[model samples]
Target: MNIVDLLPAILAVIVGLVVLVWSADKFVDGAVGVAKFCGMSTLLIGMVIVGFGTSAPEMVVSALSAVQGNPQLALGNAYGSNIANIALILGVTALISPILVQRSVLKKDLPLLIGVTVLSILLLLDGDVSRLDGVVFLAVFFGVMGFNIWKEKKSANKATEPAEAGELAEVSESAEKPMSLGKSIFWLVLGMGLLVASSRALVWGAVDIAHSLGVSDLLIGLTIVAIGTSLPELASSIAAARKGEDDLAVGNIIGSNLFNTLMVVGIAASISPMNQIDGEVLYRDMPLMGILTLSLLVLGFRRKGDGRINRVAGIVLLLVYVAYLTILGLKTTGVL
Candidate 1:
């Protein structure tokens, strides 16, 4: 390829990275600020709103790809993103600091994550993700959210113990500072718009770059597009780690994965049924994602009290990711 022909792809990557990073910061600040403005508690905001915001990139990419009739790309993006979020994003974040897993997250959100993941896979067993499947997933998503809200309320009402009362007091204090509802809505919408626009540019650029390099769409979606869309999670988790906000890092990753599986693929399939899982994804990608999730769970269990994801775990995750990419390349080249 001519040097000049590479400019658009190169520029696309640079612009995509810039927008993704900017959007992540803006989305985090705006969502958290809006949550505080509402009567929502901090943990609720972190678990739901911030989690959803961190996943904006995957949702946009998958929905757009599905709309554009590249359903395989959509599925690959969602699956690859989940793997990247846990193995790449969380792994790197933990390497920065020993992320402390909150009891609530461990007992509540983690199970939900695992359940949703398995549920999604089961839904796809028919070889396609239909609109009906999307509806089921969305229903489950809302049910989980509702259960969380109920739990929060119940916890607040039954704060008889000193520790429980103290927790309730903190929740009440945080909810006291309400901002104008209209202003909060405005920021939420604006941040979402930026996220959508940037994701489109990123995906288009990524696709163009892949085509220019004579790479198959599947390979591009699995690697470049996947990593690009995961940029938000990486940036946010890293910042959270550096700030010693371990919950934020862990929460962001888990939240992103949940949203990617439920919202991203759910919405995409709702638009139009996604194609069957490609042979490569079925044989390689899905297994890799499962392995990564299981590995993270093991690490979390092993270091339960220590609250540390050491460099060794980080290295292992990185090595796994590298091996995954190598296998993908081999398959693409017909060498495997």
Candidate 2:
């Protein structure tokens, strides 16, 4: 109940995050290396491999939270990560370098994100994320994944066409040269081991902190846990932006959000259905996520050749995120 009691839990979170980010990078590197060997498209590698790899934290954390009988933390971690992906991750990345992208590439993803955001809200309205609801999400997740694979294959085929042959550069152009498959699998196993261990430490500490602070697990998840798990996406996105791989940077955000919304929540809820819905999730969190998603959608719809989210927009997004955090702080301190 005191600061002294919170120390170990705090330390767990700190150490857990440090290891979590490091391991996720290793995981993605290994995964991407293998994908490159299979000759996957550059954009596909960014969206699926890096996006899903970085999102493994949320999946692991949420699944553990649910299995350990903390479904609120699981649900909060999923939705909260979505909020952070847009307002926090994208906002910070844009500040480092304004996001520039071809709207054609974004055509399928942004709209699909909006659709799923709305669908998630509708599912929440019944006051619970039921097992059946989780099934629906999982089915949709697999469907999206199937589409991504097909789309990637289609892109490869289209790129071979004489008219589009200009885009037929190397598949690994966005990333460094590929490593050997044996080495890739070695790091994959190592990273996955560390990733699960770190996730368990994080979940345990976060739940303990919530109990000690007399706050809901949902609150802890939405704030500390959400931000911590999202760190990999932030790091990768910034690195991609600085490297001028704008599509890769943007795809990582968009894809990560999709993974958080569907895979993270679906796995958790399927493991243990969230029959008790938190009010803040529907009233406060989902609405904020919806708004941020819509704003990002609007920012991408420029008729100009390349839609650019410039510095000013980045500042505004950051301000909105800060305002949301301020509200959480006031609520925690009983001042709201």
Candidate 3:
């Protein structure tokens, strides 16, 4: 790769990442505002609104990759972003502040996430995610969404307090006025528009970089593309953790991972037959991702009280993520 070729791709990546972060911030705010305005519960806001908002980049990027005849890139981005969400994003969030798991989250969300992870692995074991598989994924995802909505509505009168949820719920019930419906919708539309555009730019740059480096699209997606698309989750989760909205912070990670696991992969496989998914997805990425998903249950397990992921645990998660990237780099470059 000449300097000329490298420079533009690098520039595109940097600029694309910057815009993605900013737009994602606006998107989350707008989504939260809209959810509150519509009377959604805080957990629902964290999972549905914030989760969908942050996971938008992964969804768009994967869909575009599939449409462009890059199924490997699509799978890599979807599953890679899943690994990043749990290991990188959550690791950093917990490093900044210990994350507390709510009873509702442990009982409802965590087990579901584990089940989803297992399902993903089983689908990939067939060496491809078929159209039927895609349909199944979307069905399960939507069903889970419906169930969460029903549960939240059923417990509307006994909603979680702000102390457990942190600034997320507090802000909704705060004396400070919230954004108007029109304004929130405007930001939501604007953010979604920008996300689509920036994701295209990012995909272009990623393809170029992959070609230049003489690596597969999967490699690029698993690293640069994955991390870039995941910046939103990292940003939002950290902000939530700092404010002591432990459930919101943790919920964001869980929600984003779930979306990537189901919606992103499902959309990609549905649009483009992923019959030749790389072996690495099944043997390497998916296994590690499943283990990490299970680790959440172990880390959040409580003997007598609420579960907490502390700084020591945070350091361990961070180290695991760092090692993961290192191994990916080594393998991509034929060093492993």
Give a tens-digit lDDT track for model 1, residues 197-295: 676677777788779879888788667766767666677666556655566677777777777778888888888886666766666777677667666
Candidate 3 lDDT, 42-72, residue by residue in tens: 5577787778877887787788898998867
Candidate closer to the true structure by TM-score (higher is better), 1 or 3: 3
**Residue 283 lDDT, candidate 3, scale 0-100:** 86
Per-model TM-score on C-alpha atoms: 0.76, 0.77, 0.78
Which RMSD values do the candidates have, in order?
A: 4.6, 5.0, 5.3
Q: How accurate locally is residue 125 in candidate 2, as Cα lDDT from 0 to 100?
A: 93
* Best by the TM-score measure: 3
TM-score of 3: 0.78
Instruction: Give the per-residue lDDT of model 2 (tens digit) for 1-336.
Output: 788988998898888778876776666566556666665654566678677877887888888998998877877777778788888888898998998867766577778888988998899898898888888999998998899888777876675576443454544366565689898878766765676677667767877888886877657755766566776777667666776667767878778888888888888888888976888888999999999988986876686676887777888888898888889878877899
**Per model, how many backbone clashes are there?**
0, 0, 0
Q: What lDDT does the true structure give each of the candidates?
A: 0.71, 0.78, 0.79
- 2 or 3: which has the higher TM-score? 3
Error of 2 at 17 (Å): 9.7
